[model samples]
Target: MCDLMPAAQPAEKIGKMKKLRRTLSESFSRIGDCQGSDSLIKPLDTIPEDRKVQRTQSGFDPFEKPAGQVKRVHSENNACINAKSSSSGKESPKLRRHSSPSSPTSPKFGKADSYEKLEKLGEGSYATVYKGKSKVNGKLVALKVIRLQEEEGTPFTAIREASLLKGLKHTNIVLLHDIIHTKETLTLVFEYVHTDLCQYMDKHPGGLHPDNVRLFLFQLLRGLSYTHQRYILHRDLKPQNLLISDTGELKLADFGLARAKSVPSHTYSNEVVTLWYRPPDVLLGSTDYSTCLDMWGVGCIFVEMIQGVAAFPGMKDIQDQLERIFLVLGTPSEETWPGVHSLPHFKPDRFTVYSPKKLRQAWNKLGYVDHAEELASRFLQCFPKNRLSAQAALHHEYFSHLPPRLWELPDMSSIFTVPSIKLQPESGDSIQVCSKSKATSNSKH
Candidate 1:
């Protein structure tokens, strides 16, 4: 029995030795694949207890590998150490790059302690206008506060107006000083104008002289020209919307209905402007129109200024509006207005004419007799194509005799005072006066 046991022990020992050698060989090959070398020294001279145990269990040696393999493993191990060092070093600077502070995306509209709320000026579809003084600048400014608790229509309109007015910078357009957005309210700060054309005409009573009328019309045209050039359409143009300063400078206000013109055939919904100033094309259901629609309004305003009343004040219905327009300017035919028949709402049967004698009588009532007959005729033309441009009218012989300096009026900064509203340090409230700033900042990405 002892002899048999000794023989079995020798066979078992030999088999165990062969298995250990094969395992060591396989471990060396795997270490080579991982680019680890036996001869490569570790960063620390002493091995950790866990590492020593792993080496003993895996049967790894530190000096038996080929020189080429050792060099390859050393290069790979160095690269890994260098990569770890580079990664740790760069992390903080990369984090710091994005940590730099930036200005808030949008300014707060109204801070509670900013402006001293004054009396209410007026109320529109969107907001209630107020006369307020800015605590910071100590200037009096018009404040428009919008209540968002109501229907969304007015708030949206106010936002659009604020967005557009923020970028517009012209003599004839109203200036937007600051915008305040509170928890449930939006407020707009504007430069205060003395009165609008409606009130101005009412106060004058006798109607502006033809020369003054011409001057006002010229300024109105200039404002319109600027707006049109910027691809903006002042959908509502009337005496009410035309604000006049104390020095009689005219400014186009109320951009709730105003829109930038880009596409060719964008049809706005019906009933944009007041009936009296609405053009023939607008009344004929022509939605896809051009700046020519505004020209028609210009003609209306011109005639209203000259006559001391609306030129074509129509009744409630569209047909009545059409008839009133034709009554004053005479009916338009295919020959008179080349595309008259093609209009969306064109109906030849509804055409009629008031007495020419009565029409002339109305013109005389408006005090247009002293001016050149051709001037009135040109302005009163029914066709949008025939209407005078703001620039052309400025150069008309009517204004030629006036001083050239009349066109270059006093600086706006001198005439009007802008009020600065104070804001809390963390409130992020500020005013953007120029249109360009408003456009770039307010536009959504």
Candidate 2:
């Protein structure tokens, strides 16, 4: 798996490069919006034109959570990838490079020549990821090569991502190893993970094993809790953004849209998270939000893992997305959500109000598992403030069956470090084999 060719020969290198280029052509297109398997459900039915909700012109949304002031803290224990910024302003994007003595295992700072690109993995609007090997330590790493625009020096998103990631060091979060800056590009070296949750689900469809699902969900919440406690909001939480190691470790990746919630009064862009996983409050034009902005996506992902399909796979625009969510969770009213009438896009007459359905009613798999529906319902609340915090959800009855010592692990320690805690074989193995066999049979024609 390490070397694509038997040995380095000129002809073989050319062949390998050609083959890699071909593979890259057929690989994931959008790095930020990483593509995976097709949705397991049909495209949602579009809303009637008569009931179509009008779009709003609000610049950005606001999240008003009162938290302590962010303080500048330096650590000598370990050095992170790159960049540091003290200001959490929603508009200004400026970060200074910070360096420290990294753990003996990691490299301090890497130049362009420090790593060798092996193959292209994915390409996004701003960056292209390559499967790379570090020349210094001879370790595999993910190289996120971001091209610099002539007009803008360094992309603000890249600056924000680096600044936030530099301060975050957790087992469940993807580790940034080194930063390689060049005149034309900024390459961020990250610990290469085997696959993401989106691709993992594609391999084993029709729902994952109950044990495996539990483990994945636990690790996800563990990661989120760490970030939320630090006042950092991972605005995007889709399965593609979640990296899954071959050892079944889940690490949150792609901090391009993440923000540190230091200023409660600051309003953020409403066009942040992907449409499918976006919360309803944001869709309703409520810019002011809190940490619960991410909790809604957590519920959607939870249901998707259980049912083997998206909870609400809207095909059209924001209104269509809202309709799919409202169809299940019911329409929000003044009684359901206070200040609902004050939002920029809430039109009471435009929507047909229906009572909220139970979580099991929408996702049948939840009914089969004990305490699963209750926990999901806690996260899928229509009101922004009603969603359960990641920290509180970790101690819910749903996770009670897990080992008690799991709660005692350090921030950098994985739950798998505990004895007898590992991912179970996916229950859909038979289905996976059948699908592969069918595909192979069809290919012969």
Candidate 3:
């Protein structure tokens, strides 16, 4: 009976070992299923700081990265920030990271501040201009507050203007000091000028003195020369866009429509410049315009300065504009202009054969010299290629000496030094005049 008991104990021990082996095998099988479930069981905070800030394998520039995609950034020893998954597939949700000060999306520097509105300068379809002073620096500035639209958050005109102005630094061009972004609108802060040429003309009832006119034109040509050198087109070059400082410094402004010249394959719009200042080529629908396009406007300005009226004030439509132009410069043909007939707006029947007036006729009729007309003629060439470039125009004989080498005008150097003379708003009349001028640029237009 004792021998039988000992054998039974060994058999009992073997049965116990078999039961323990079964439990252990089941636990190992469950552990094999928990391979990808590491994240589900482990908290994100437990991840090593180095592991959370790993570089992404998604090859893309951080600045140009599209939204929704996980942009793995090296966070500064922060916990793992897992990106939410819309629908996770075979792979787990990707982790994302963000910039820390040294990133490209960081804030850039600028100088913008509160300004007391001294007077309203001008208003356009997109913005309102006011003469203002900086609260921080006490510097005068022209504040242009642009109206924002929902469809296009900020207009490309404002964006392009800022971009171009950032690179362009010349005394002749308007200085864009700062661009302020607000929740509702964009503000362009420009260096303040007392008034533009149009307002200045209004102030001077009769006209600018001949010496002043000569000085102004010389400055205009000089500025235009700088602009052309940079391959930029000031598509709008009317008197209203020319800002004049109190000390007689002229700067080109209102670059809303200006664009860098297009490559040879593309063409720009022709209906940009005001009809009166629009060149013959542009009016005739030439899209491949170059720097000479502005020269035509310069010619018209020369005439307007002399006559105190728009030279070719076209009545209703483009046809009328062409008629006005041809009335003064004569109708074009293959003889006068080789490819005149090939222009998009060219129609032989629409043109009438009109003999051109001598350009010097305006200068001569207004008691000025032949050189004024000579300069005007060079700018008013029927063919754009034949027109004088801004650089060439500056070197023309007209600028070589003072006005009236057709000998009746004053000295040019004297007017160049003329200080900005602003009239102090008096008891009532001066205020009234300023108020009228400030009544939105739309009213003036």
Clashes of each: 7, 5, 2
| Candidate 3 Cα deviation (angstroms), residue 445 | 2.1
Q: On residues 1-445, what C-alpha lDDT tens digit does candidate 3 reach at each position? A: 0000011244554565455444322221100100111122211112222222121112111111222221121110011110111011121111112113364544222222234465454444566556555443455556666656767556656655655665566666777665555434556667665556654554453445666677778778777777777777777787767876665667778776676533231346776677668888888888877777788888888777665566776645678778878887899888898888989999989888888888655345344744777778888888777888887776677666643331221322323333432223212111103232222211113
Q: Judge candidate 1 against the unseen true structure and give its global Cα lDDT, from 0 to 1.
A: 0.51
Query: Whole-model Cα lDDT per candidate?
Result: 0.51, 0.64, 0.55
lDDT for model 3, on a 0 to 1 scale? 0.55
TM values, all candidates: 0.63, 0.74, 0.65
- The residue-by-residue lDDT of candidate 1 on 1-445, one tens digit each, is 0000011244564565455444322221100001111122212112222211100001111112222122110101011011111122112111121111244432112332345665455444434555555454445555666655534322445645665675677777777665444434555666666566655554444445565675577678777777776667777777767876655567788776676543233445455665666778777776655566677777677766666666765534568767877776678887777888888889887777443334445566444434434454555556666766555655666556555655565433211222221111211122212233322221100
Candidate that would win on lDDT: 2
Q: Could you tell me which 10 consecutive residues in candidate 1 have the lowest summed lDDT?
A: 72-81
Sort by lDDT, best first.
2, 3, 1
Q: List the residue pairs that clash in candidate 1.
A: 109-180, 109-181, 110-180, 166-435, 167-435, 167-436, 168-435
- TM-score comparison, 2 vs 3, better candidate: 2
Q: Looking at model 2, how many pairs of residues clash?
A: 5
